[model samples]
Target chain A: MYGWIWRRLPGNAWVRAVISLVLILAVVYVLFQYVFPWAEPLLPFGDVTVDGASAGAGAGREEGAAR
Target chain B: MPVRLVIRTFSELCITVGAVIVLFVVYVLYWTGVKAADASDGEIHRLQDQWSRGRIELPAPGATASAAPPDATQEPQKSQAPQATRGAPTAPTTRSAPAASAGTEPARRPARSTAPAARPPAYRDGKPFAVMYVPRFGRAWDWPVLEGTGVNTLKKGLGHYPGTAALGGRGNFAVAGHRRTYGDPFKDVPLLRPGDAVVLTDGASWFTYRVDRRAYRTVPTDIGVIDPVPEKSGFRVPGRYLTLTTCEPEWGSSHRLIVWARLEATRPVTDGKPPALRS
Candidate 1:
């Protein structure tokens, strides 16, 4: 019965739909949930947060010089 | 096949970016570790010993008279300015120490050397430089008495020389330090009046540089401050000069406050050479 239901769904369309859901979930859980809290301890006053690329540049590289 | 290739390329791009991020973090951690290690070496400890106390009986003010850590292995110095944290150069820079915490300090601009006096100051006995005193800032400011160009020894206290003279192989031997911070070794440096003396020792010989003139000047990174004739030559002639530099405007200077002295005379370090420094 389950196989029949899954089989009824369009393969490519369902696959696309599932990927879209996973992407959205990743954004919410990984970025919003985990990242925001991780940064809160470093500089509490500033509300805006830098992404992985920008923070990596600041923490690891020289401030103004190019990579 | 084309779609699969596109996804693979994107994933590869992400991996490359991640690798770069890891490498950068490692670099910062390495330098921070190195700088920390350099600060506590025996040289610095010896310098601190020299600065902490002195035995020479200096003449009272106005008269040509005399003067005067720990490391967590990893953490970069939090309290000091970047220059303050760095060790002395093999040959230090001119010791400009730019005002910005992160921006580079321009090296001291060299003025022409003054003509050598009847008796050019010589390193007597074994002493190279003498301990000059700064009265106001109190205890923290004592420095070593270096013989020729002071840039190398100044690193023991001033951090690194910002430009040329720091190399220690050249014309005028220049020295530098902080004003109010870094123990404010040079905080009262700007207050030095004419006739004040900077004595240098080579252990056996002592040389004195007199506070002949003082001025304020702007310095650019490329400008060499300790050239044979480091200063601008207009009415002045050339010879060996000693310039003391620190921040301007007393408490703080957006620009440099400079005190230029000519080599005057030197005394020999005698059998009873008391500490040449005082707190």
Candidate 2:
């Protein structure tokens, strides 16, 4: 993905380098400001608790009570 | 020849340094967000599946229908006919007929009781127990609220402070999310104005809270903002409160930004939609 972006830039080595940096920063800014937050609900990264315990345990307890 | 060789080596060094800097930037700003988003997406799917499969145990009165023990089949009967004699005081036929009819009436009311018993589940650290919605941020401004404020949970979405009050409860329900990285869930929180609705749902009911105050600069050690009655929130007595905290300056965490909201209304999920989401 990044290679495609880099190859699409229009510049010599020095100019390309500067443009690439700016482009990269702009992409990062947009991701932080809009894209990532919008996609947060779809991620699976935060299922574990900080106490070294998994949420599944509480879920299991609820299940047991429920059953 | 020697001078030419040195010149060539100097240019190579510059190229290598520049490449290293560019790679570092990609790693920090791009790669991390990608990984965090992927993780958050997985959790969301799992949560939705659990809800769909009836794994989430509704609290109390609602619990009996889906959670009754095998040996306690009589419990539902008891709830259905509260006036029925335990030891057959009256004619079984005459009493049970009316009790059966009365039982269905209370069953309908349990759906409403669901709200008061809809205490946020005691989820494991990073698991989502509720989803937050801020119409002030637009219709797409919703994120799953994980159970605890651990590093892992914050990376996925908003993390609920462990010691704070439960969502829509009679105390402060404090949460924290990233301001810049790890999906930047609170990136636009600063734009929220007073009276803006900050709503959340736990699959049972919608809890709408109205933003009443915003604090732009607060020290990391300031716990008063998450207090039951948040300082500077303009509230003197205890009430349902929602406190949202994120890093300040949009790029740094030298200080914190706090937004305080008061619970305004709660509607059951079966009620179709809350006013905050009507538009």
Candidate 3:
């Protein structure tokens, strides 16, 4: 797949390399600023701590305290 | 170009875009936290400077003694006045005589009653109002509580929900922060057990809240957790409540993690550190 793109380039190696780099950066910038934030609500990718840990850790202290 | 060559080129472009998307996720989840932490730290330092400059004040420890004589008409209600003074000094008074005189009148009223009356420091959208210390998170865990939850405000620190009760006021004082990105101010929120103290100081007094319960799951649209009488907060009446909320599951905003704490004590900053903060 990559070989085909390299062959289709209008210029030599350096020009193709520059074009590739620019395209990659543009793609990254658009995704970072627009696409990702828009899709964030639909993604399930932010939790760093394990689930149920707070409940388990807080249970004993909660019971010990009188409401 | 040949059909096979065109197909190959398109596939290659797809692969590159796919890789870029993956990198974008990393930038959002990790890089933003790094940048937000730097911004939040800068805000925290600025607020600390403001506090140190005497812009915020707790009433002078003995101001009430002199205040009693001037407001003699309030003598019947004087007993409860000292308690209000215990938490706030009734705006910064430059003159000792005037401060004492002013203190007596407000002291006669309830702290919550006078809090809203005093002109609170004009909090700009991204400005810090108070500094929150969650000892349960760490000895060094502190975040500047900013005025609003706008995107710019969250980048700096925890954002105070607009239209909610002011800190230490009569209604629910609520704040929202990022759970994972944006410095992860509430990253360890789940570790807060019942009875854990969440202390906030706006340079005048320390308002300590005792965590009553932790609501592990609430839908993203659940605004009830921030209500004056928050649903599932274990409170039945209107009172001073502090609601700390963050995105749940550490990585996603599929739900919210809500922690409810009731105002347990309000002490003048002059009284030294509250016991919950005794290191």
Question: Residue A45 CA error for candidate 3 (Å)?
Answer: 7.5
> What class would a CAPRI assessor give candidate 3's docking?
incorrect
Off by over 4 Å in 1: A1-67, B1-141, B145-156, B159-170, B219-225, B233-235, B249-253, B271-279
Better structure of 1 and 2 per lDDT: 2
Better of 1 and 3 by DockQ: 3
C-alpha-based local distance difference test score of model 1: 0.37
lDDT for residue A22 in candidate 3, whole number 0-100: 90
Candidate 3 CA-lDDT value: 0.64
lDDT value, residue B99 of candidate 3: 25
**Residue B6, model 3, lDDT:** 83
- Compute the lDDT of residue B235 as modeled in candidate 1: 15
Per-residue lDDT over B137-166 for candidate 3, one digit per residue giving the tens place of the 0 to 100 score: 999888899876655566678877666677
**lDDT (C-alpha, whole model) for all candidates:** 0.37, 0.60, 0.64
Fnat per predicted structure, each in turn? 0.00, 0.00, 0.13
Count clashing pairs, candidate 1: 48
